[model samples]
Target: MKRCAALCAGVGMLAVLAGCSGTPEETPVASSPSTIGTTSAPAPAASVPPAGPLGSAAYQAELTKLEQSLAGPLRTLTRVRTAEGLTEAMTTLADSLDAASSQLADLTVTRRLTAVHEVLQDSLGSAAETLSNSDRTEANARCGGVAYTSQKVQRQLRADLSGATVPLDRLGLKFGGTLPDPGPEPKPVRPSNGAIVIRSGPTGTGRLKITNGTANDVAVSIVTDGKPPAKPHVMMYIQAGKAATISRIGGAYHIYFKSGADWSPTRRQFGEDCSFQKFEQAFGRNESWQVNLEPTLGGNAKTTEVEAY
Candidate 1:
């Protein structure tokens, strides 16, 4: 009985092992390849409408009036003065014309007449100033003062003109229709990058050095707090290296430097770089050696007492 029971148990185990073996999973079937080819449509092209007439009858009439107004004066100026003056006069005339032109230029397109007008006006004003001044030096000095102010004015005008022109150009195209060939594209403006360094001279007599580390040439000015010492002379020297020398009897305090042809005051300031109360004379680039600050304050003063180089 025991042998029979053991044999039965082994058969049961075999049956269990056979049940564990299962059927293999079926592989998925893919669909047939499609016969249709890719249908990529071409992109639609931009439709440009044909150009129409340039200006309205009213606009044309106004332009004619401006041309007449400017012509005689411009021609007279051209004949009498140097080329510089002639150029200025012509520019002014062109600007005036542009101002008139802009009124029509926008029939709804881009108009730059206002900008042109402003530039011309400025050029005319500067020219007039130069003509009235006693000498070139005075004229140049006046011109410098006007430069920044005039630039700001022109920019404002340009913005206003642009606002007017865009709508006009469009209106003309949509309604009155047609214009002369579009004016030239605006010239691209390239930005500049650079740095300016101002160094003060030694104690009794000192010099200031300006270095132009930029691609373009720049102008600079030197100023001192309070009246300069008697015989006070402040000189400027420029180029790649070394500060200018100032020869003075007394030391100067609170020295300042201004940058640009416009001479805007810079952050650089000196308190006690040199011990003396003032400098004596203006120095220029011709002198290579920097003025010594040590002697101005007396023997005991530290070199640091002079302005930080």
Candidate 2:
């Protein structure tokens, strides 16, 4: 009995050992041959289409609409105020671009749509660039016009103020001169025939003389280089043969010959005589001077001469 029990215990131990030693059933680990050396499929790549022409028919239509909207306000601004009109036009353009951007933002990403997407992007970009450039140009032009007009008006006002002259009647009262008989009828002032002589001095001084050869008193105006004479430096006036000296008023050297007057010596008077003296002084002694004679209706004389001084 003891031997049999010992043998039985040994047998139990052997069975446990065999159970532990048996190959694990591998849990039937189902391995796939496909997974052995295969890689996972790659995620789809984003597609980019090639850009197309910027001025396609569709793009041209949109461009036309934008241009027309801009043109009206631009034209109006050109004729009147520019700032407000330009601003309004720019706002409209921005709104249009915003709408376009919204449309572009909603585009669905797809490989097949890549080409269309690229074309749209290029067209939008080109349009935006063009509009921006146009806006800058228009704004600059408007600002320049405003500045130019402001300067012109200011200059004209200053000139009118500086050239203001006291009426002859007021001056007579100050001088205690009896009012000349209310003249029955003064003859119409007429321009006299004369030759304009321009001379240059060694010291860089320019001299102008007008000699009257005709009999009728003439009203005459002298223009230099097609520009009206400036006051206080260059001056224009009629003179009789009496040795009267006419002077430079502003930028003009002028002497008017009375119908019966011969040549006269005129003193140079600036400021009071001419308003544009500062501009005229730019022509130095060695420079050329242009003289234009304008008569009431029918006579016009134009001549140019360089100073010999």
lDDT values, one for every candidate: 0.29, 0.28
lDDT of 1 by residue, 1-116 (tens): 00011111121111000100011232222222212221222111112211322224333343345445545544444243232453354344344433333333222211323333
Error of 2 at 226 (Å): 14
Regions of model 1 farther than 4 Å from truth:
1-62, 66-99, 102-143, 147-225, 228-232, 240-242, 261-309
lDDT digits (tens) for residues 115-231 of candidate 2: 433443334334333344443434332323332322232233223222111221122211102111222322333223232233222222343333322233322333343342322
* Global CA lDDT computed for model 1: 0.29
Compare the candidates by lDDT and give the number of the best one.
1
The Cα RMSD of model 2 versus the native structure comes to 46.7
| Superposed model 2: Cα runs more than 4 Å off | 1-83, 109-112, 129-135, 143-309
Q: Residue 253's C-alpha lDDT in candidate 2? A: 31
